[model samples]
Target: MSGLGFETRQVHAGAIVDAEAGARVTPIYQSAGYVFDSFDDGVERFAGRSARRAYSRNDNPTNVVAARRIADLEGGVDGVLVASGQAAIAMALSALAQAGDHILTTDRLYEGTREMIRGALRRQGLEFEALPIDADEDAWVAAVRPSTRAIYAESIANPLGEVVDLALLGRVSARTGVPLVVDNTVATPYLCRPVEHGAAVVIHSTSKWLGGHGSVIGGAIVDGGGFDWTAAAARFPHLHEPRPHGAPSFAERFGAAAYSAYLRSVVVLEHGPTVPPSSTFLLLHGIETLSLRMERHVANAVAVADALQDHPAVARVHYPGRADGQAERVARLLPDGAGSIVSIDLAGGRDAARTFLDGLRLVSQMTHIGDVRTLAIHTGSTIHGKLDDAERAGLGITEGLVRISVGIELVDDIVADLEQALDAVLAAGERTATRRSAAAQLEAVHP
Candidate 1:
């Protein structure tokens, strides 16, 4: 399979033989529980001594299919399917850190993730420090305190469309003995597998690209199985310590399986952040077409960004693929295209941004990205709206910023709609400014 291509793996990796039904496609085992042959069998299942299933919360056939498929796609040892992308983040972080532990994160994280780190976890006594994604490598090394548990960042940040330097961050992880967790939702495994580049953990929001059609709300955390928890024993007591029932130290018992095994048997099972088997099924289906869809998505996005850069109402376009103004981080990390998301700073600020959004004829204004039809969102008013003025500013989410996720739609039609929208906003802005100036002049003369 290592010699096989991604498209081939996406189509063929996780289909298991149906012993009872003779089904080619993985059947949806929508049941809440599974039965054992005898009382001793149940004990064997609960003890993690058997491969058989015990409860839906622990594992399910449908969920296993999804997890296996995702693991193959991302080159991970195993993956845990969770309720949503946020759940994946919560479970993954909680698995690594406890109360009084600290997490070092990039400030340019997705809005909900930042909220989860700074807002929700802070109240629970867990601490986090935010640093610029493009900060000096030494700055990252210096930020690691004795209590620092993990370093987290997105593969390609939302709205900003900045690609992170995985190898450099990997160096930080190696030096500091802290695992690097990355949210690969934007890039998906189709474009990039962070694990291949030294990420200890790769998390995803299947609601965006992995589910492809935006039909399912799901997420996954893939374990690279390379981080040695015992080496950082003092920092991560949860992984290093022996279990209550003499269940063995996770680092000793599982070794490479430490992160994922803990995530499933401990956090996911106990906290109940399980994805419905039906949702997992949807995600698996979407993954089958992931490679093909991502190619079109990137191509369409490049065309859209190029066209938007030329529009009068577009002040700037932020797509890492552009030649002259490209972020050097992108070339180092994203050798493939920068992904489908394009963030543009519209010329006329908030009001003009709204006009451009309203004038768009074909692109739907939606909260979700990575769909078949083009979608547009104004970050300050929609996705990042939860952040107050100061927070938004800190995150570089300006009032005029419009985030567009290009789909498989015809590049020509998409550009035409954008052109019209931009033209309308600029025309309206010029007229309004002129009218206001004329009105002030007339009032002064009459007075």
Candidate 2:
């Protein structure tokens, strides 16, 4: 399995062959707790001195399988499953930083992630500063303070398909001694493995593409297992500090997987944002065909983007792989494709977005992305609605921008729906202009 292809590994990695019942598929271990061999065994498990799991909250066989499977796909050492993508972000950050610590991040990210950073995490007393996506390595290094614990960014941003320079950020992480955390929900492990680019931690909202059927909600955090926690002792005292009696510190005990070990044993254990084994069961199934599904997703996206460009109402198409200066970055980072999000800025503004959304027949207008079905949303009004007009403008959230999560449907059908919607936007704009012209004439006659 170590040298297997991604397609093969997605199906086989972290899978358990039940020797007891000879089950082929991983069965759901639905019990609240695992029975121990004896009282001493329970103590061992509780004390983290045994290999057997004592409780289902932190360690369930089914959940472990999903976590390991995602970690394997991302080329990481260890992983943990959580209730949602937000939990993955929160848990990973909580493990790395505490109150009064600072975090550096790229300006472009999912609105949901941004909200968490601005709203909940900020309320917790952790400080955050966003750098421009195009910030150089030196700029990132300069931003790091003694309290800076992490450099966070999304692999491919939401609504607007901005692709961050992950390799550059990875280099920044190395130079600054801060771990790089990446949210790879949009790209998934099939499209991009952040660890290979130098990310110390990889995050995912498995509810999206990983659970391709849109039936389950889950998240995962993967440790790259490369950062030298011992070397960064001054910055990360917890990883280096020894335990109460004679116990070794996380870095001494887990070595490469120290961060993940601490996250699972402490942060996640205390917070208890555990995902159910049933969700993991569905997630595992979705991952089996991830490679296959992503290929079609990319293809449909490229086709849709091409179609949208020729429409009269489209002002711009925000696909990552376009010739828009980032062509090289997209080619280097995302050779397979620049993911399935193809956002179009309408020339007719917010009114046009409303009309276009109203005219959609095949594509579902909703909040979620990376689903098997094509999903569309006006981010300025939904995801970024909390932000005022100025804030939305700063993030390039135009009034008419509509994000399309291209699915594996027939290219023609998807294109047809989009084209018809665009045509309606143009027709609505024309009617409005005509009414305005008639009103102007009436005003002049009255004067």
Lowest lDDT 10-residue stretch of candidate 1 = 321-330
> Tens digits of per-residue lDDT for model 2 on 37-112?
8999988888887988988888999999999999999999999999999999999999999999999999998888
Clashes of each: 0, 0
Residue 168's C-alpha lDDT in candidate 2? 98
Whole-model Cα lDDT of every candidate shown, in order:
0.86, 0.91
Q: After superposition, how far is residue 410 of candidate 1 from its true place, in Å?
A: 1.0
TM-score per prediction, in order, is 0.96, 0.98
Give candidate 2 misplaced runs (Cα > 4 Å).
Answer: none
Clash pairs, model 2 backbone: none
Error of 2 at 174 (Å): 1.3
